[model samples]
Target: MSTFLTLLRRDCAQLLLGGRRGGALLPVLFFLAVAMLYPFAVGPDAPLLARTGGGVIWVAALLAAILPLDRLIEPDLELGLFDQFALRGISEEGVVAVRVLAHWLSFGPPLMLAALPASALVGIDGAQLRLIEWGLLAGTPGLAALGVLVAAITAGLRGGAALGGLLVIPLAVPLLVFGAGSLSAGGEAGLALTGAVSLVLLAITPFAGAAAIKSSRG
Candidate 1:
């Protein structure tokens, strides 16, 4: 438990202070602002806003998710923390898990908070707002897992941003499809199933990322 707290503290320090000023918050805010812009760009037709809402939110979420992977593995690799953890008694699996928790806290919650206003702008229903929140809650762990895996795979690459998106976006398609599809369908069972699928994706991503990271690191 202490180790977990230590890892969270370490990650927060890096996010809040280690990079360029406002390192973590900047990307999150950028996504929020961009999401807000879409309604204006598309004009104020109600149907259009409602139709585009889910896609806008999902795509913006995906883009926002991309920003963090740039620094994800680099910090540990540069600071020798990765090797230190491996040497000291932390399993790579444990390290990855803790980092995911930290990453989610730093990135995911802020993105979700930012989503609230955008959700309103996009004309999401109250029930749909809850569904979107649930989908995001369940789905974002997968995003984090994908980030760690891609960050590990592109650990030493200069073009990691390009590579990370290439690797992650395709994998995230199901999340977008089902997430948006649920709200479009507008049935109780549809929403419930969508949330269920999202939970399944969350369940699957960590193990897959864990396998990928172990393979890449080993």
Candidate 2:
């Protein structure tokens, strides 16, 4: 228990504090850039911005989630940290689970906060912003899990980071659909589905990521 907490704290610091892997701020900046540029790209059509802003936020969040994938598992693997954990009788699954939580912490809540200004930039109202916040809260865990899982699978491969980013987009379509769809009328069901998909991905990620890490050792 102590070791787990310690590792969790270490990872959260590494990811959030802007080590060589970059910090949580990179994704937040990218997210805001998207929001800020989107209005210009489409011109000053307020209704259009309001109507489409939630989906844009969802897409931005998805892309922002991808930015940190290369650093998530590969850096530790390169440092032989996983081996050290193994020597100490810690399972890969446990490490990966801790990492997922840390990764989510590094970006998820920050994105939720960033969304407030982003909402203004994109012309979404208070009601729509509330739904967007709920969607992000329910869905970002799945994004984090997916990012870690993909990073573990592609670790040690040539050009793995780019490959991981590509893989994340396609694999994350379900979360994207339900998350963005939740902005529409009769959208509570979409929120439920988003949470359900998030739960499934969270459930599967630890074991799948552990297996991927083990296989990469061969």
Candidate 3:
């Protein structure tokens, strides 16, 4: 238990505190940039912005999740950190689990906070904003899990970072659909589906990531 907490703290510092991998700020800024630029790109149609803004936020959050993918597992693998953990009797699955939590902490809540200003920039109403927040809360964990899983799979490959981003986009379509769809009238069911998908991804990520890491090492 103590060891897990230590790993969690170390990873959160590396990801959240900008220790070589860059901070959580980049994703938040990118998210805000998407919101800020979207209004200009689509013209000043307030109704259009209000209707489409939730989807834009969902897409921005997805893209923001990508920015940190390369750093998630690759850096540790390169440094032989996994071997050290193994020597200490730590399983890859356990490390992966800790990483998923840390990665989510690094970006998820901050994105939720950033969403407030982003919601205004995109012209969404308060009711829709509330749905968006709920959707993000439920969905970002899956994003974090997916990011770590992809990073583990692509850790040793050439151009792995770019590959990881491409992989994430297609794989995350379900999350995007349900999360954004939740904002529509009579679409509350979408939020439940989004959370269900998140739970599934979370359940699978640790084992999948552990296998990927082991395979890479072989």
Candidate 4:
């Protein structure tokens, strides 16, 4: 338990407080930038913006999740940090689990916070903004876990960053469908389904990431 706490702290520092690189500030800025640009491109049709803004937010969040992918696992792998963890009897699963938690904490909450201004920019009302926030809360965990999975898989490969982005798009469809789909329906069912998917991804991430890390070492 102590070791896990220590590792979690280390992961958080590396991923959340490493200044400009991993403070999670960058992804929030990128997400808001996307939301900000979307309105101008689509013109000031308030009705159109209001109707589609939530979905646009979802897309921005999804892309923002990808922004940190290449750095997630590669930094540790390259520094042989995983090797040290293994030597200390820290299983890859344990490392990956903590990493998943740290990853989500790093960007997920901030993205949620940033969504408020984004909602205003896109012209969503208070109610719609609430739904979008709810949807993101349910779904960002899955997106975080998905990012870790992709990062682990592509950590050491050539052109891995590009490959990771491409790989993430298809896998992210379900989250996009259920999460972004929820806003249109104005129902809890879609949010519930999104959470279910998130739980599944969270459950599998440790093992899958461990496997991918091991495979990369070979």
lDDT of 2: 0.95
Put the candidates in lDDT order, highest first: 3, 2, 4, 1
**Cα error of candidate 2 at position 130, Å:** 0.4
Ranking by TM-score: 3, 2, 4, 1
lDDT for each residue of candidate 3 in 1-218, tens digit (9 for 90 to 100): 99999999899999999776578999999999999999999999999999999999999999999999999999899999999998999999999999999999999999999999999998898999999999999999999999999999999999999999999999999999999998989999999999999999999999999999989889
Pairs that collide, model 4: none
Evaluate residue 83 in candidate 4 and report its C-alpha lDDT on the 0 to 100 scale: 86
Model 4: lDDT equals 0.92
For candidate 4, the per-residue lDDT at 138 reads 94
lDDT of 1: 0.71
C-alpha RMSD for every candidate: 2.6, 0.7, 0.6, 1.1
Lowest summed lDDT over 10 consecutive residues: which window, candidate 3? 17-26
RMSD of 1: 2.6
Where in model 2 is the C-alpha error above 4 Å?
Answer: none
As for TM-score, the candidate ahead, 1 or 3, is 3
**Which model, 1 or 2, shows the larger TM-score?**
2
Q: What is the lDDT of residue 187 in candidate 2?
A: 81
- Tens-place lDDT digits, model 4, residues 93-171: 9989999999999999999999999999999999888888899999999999999999999999999999999999999
Model 3 bad stretches (over 4 Å): none
Off by over 4 Å in 1: 16-21, 186-218
How accurate locally is residue 142 in candidate 4, as Cα lDDT from 0 to 100?
Answer: 98
